[model samples]
Target: CAISQEELSHARDSLTSAQSALNNIQQQLSTSVALVDDTVVSSHPDVKAAAAQLRQAFLANARSTLVAPVTGYVAKRSVQLGQRIQPGTATMAVIPLDQLWIDANFKETQLGKMRIGQPVEISSDLYGSDVKYSGTIDSLGAGTGSAFALLPAQNATGNWIKIVQRVP
Candidate 1:
């Protein structure tokens, strides 16, 4: 009986030790889970990167929907539906008829007395000289058309006379 009691006590001790070890393991697992719970997904580096990518994609999708900067009429359309457009593509033209102002290129010598908001008389070929349109100079162009031409003139070699350019 004494030997059996000793064996039984030894078994109980072993069981207690195993239960304590299990409790410690459970505590460690809970601590790990708590750390995960404390972390916010938005603050996570991977999640934040994904969110930034999503924002860029959303902006790209919004860009696909073309919206005119000003209220205007669609002058021309060159692109078809679902057509892949490249960057700097001339897809369409918008003409603001109400804001349409004629850009007159005047000689550099002619700009001495001219100033912005100066009223001027305009006559078009469509209308005879009898009909004149009164307008004010809205704005002057920064440079001449030749200066901004796609293929600018190479004036280094030829007999280059200093010619005054027109401002539009």
Candidate 2:
């Protein structure tokens, strides 16, 4: 009976140690799963970072296809197949002839009576006066062309020259 009691006590001790080990393993597993379960898939930092990388890759792939916003005539195309274009590079030009506006330059004095929406008659040498096109003054020039030139006229110089200014 004494030997049986000793063996029973030893078994109890082994059972307690096993239970403690199992509890520790369960705690570790719960902690690992908590990282992925507490938050939504989209809001999780790891998932969000992965989604952003996928979006960046999608944009990089989409750069190969060029989509123009407006429907118009392609005046010129300078892009070649498999050509690498830098940012802000001129690839092509689209000219919408339907929305064309004529830029007419006139003397500064001539713009005094010119108002917006005023009707004007236009005659081109190529089309002749027989094809007189009716047009309206869209906008008046803010300043003379020389004022916005690459090298503007210096009237403040000691040898200043008075000249008639033309505005467009």
Candidate 3:
């Protein structure tokens, strides 16, 4: 051999180092293969944890969507943006225009001979009185509005006074 003893020794040391690296890699491969089993990928602990996190993310995404029971405009949301509310909280209100009713009050004297299904001409201050809205009288009230007013005049009191009552 033309190589010197020192060079041969150095080459041997390099070869030994390379062999050690290869052995370590091969051992790692064997260990990795042993870790694989008949369990499905989803059944692995790490995969399960990831799947749980994914499910939590999906739930969070679902929570962000406000699905009203009725197909109507969102009248209100009790909670503000990014506000944390407990589950089953009443967070929104919907006013379905399709199912709406107007509570029109009229003087008791005006309801003379009025019956259900009577055509009514309505107007609002929002639009001018010229913009009349035609509607039908659904039903008549049995009592006057003063009877059900929030602050019903204590008529039985000493300061009782005469007041005209309205009806719906």
TM-score of every candidate: 0.46, 0.48, 0.60
Q: After superposition, how far is residue 23 of candidate 1 from its true place, in Å?
A: 80
- lDDT per residue (tens digit) for residues 1-168 in model 1: 257888999999999999999999999999999989889878989999999999999998898998888888997899998789899999999988567778788888888888889998988889789899888888888888788788977878779687888887
In candidate 3, position 160 carries an lDDT of 60
Residue 120 error, candidate 1, Å: 1.7
> Model 1 — which ten-residue stretch has the worst lDDT?
96-105
lDDT of each: 0.88, 0.86, 0.83
The residue-level lDDT of candidate 1 at 89 comes to 95
By TM-score, the best candidate is 3
Taking all chains together, the TM-score of candidate 3 against the true structure is: 0.60
lDDT of candidate 3 at residue 56, scale 0 to 100: 100
Which one is best on lDDT?
A: 1
Estimate, for each residue in 1-168, the C-alpha lDDT of model 2 and write its tens digit: 257888999999999999999999999999989876776768978889999999998998897777777767786799988789998999999877567679998988787789999998989999888998787889988889898789956667578677789998
For candidate 3, lDDT tens digit of each residue in 70-161? Answer: 77888676889888888789887888967766887888778886889988787889998889877788888888887777895655668866
Count clashing pairs, candidate 3. 0
* TM-score, cand. 1: 0.46
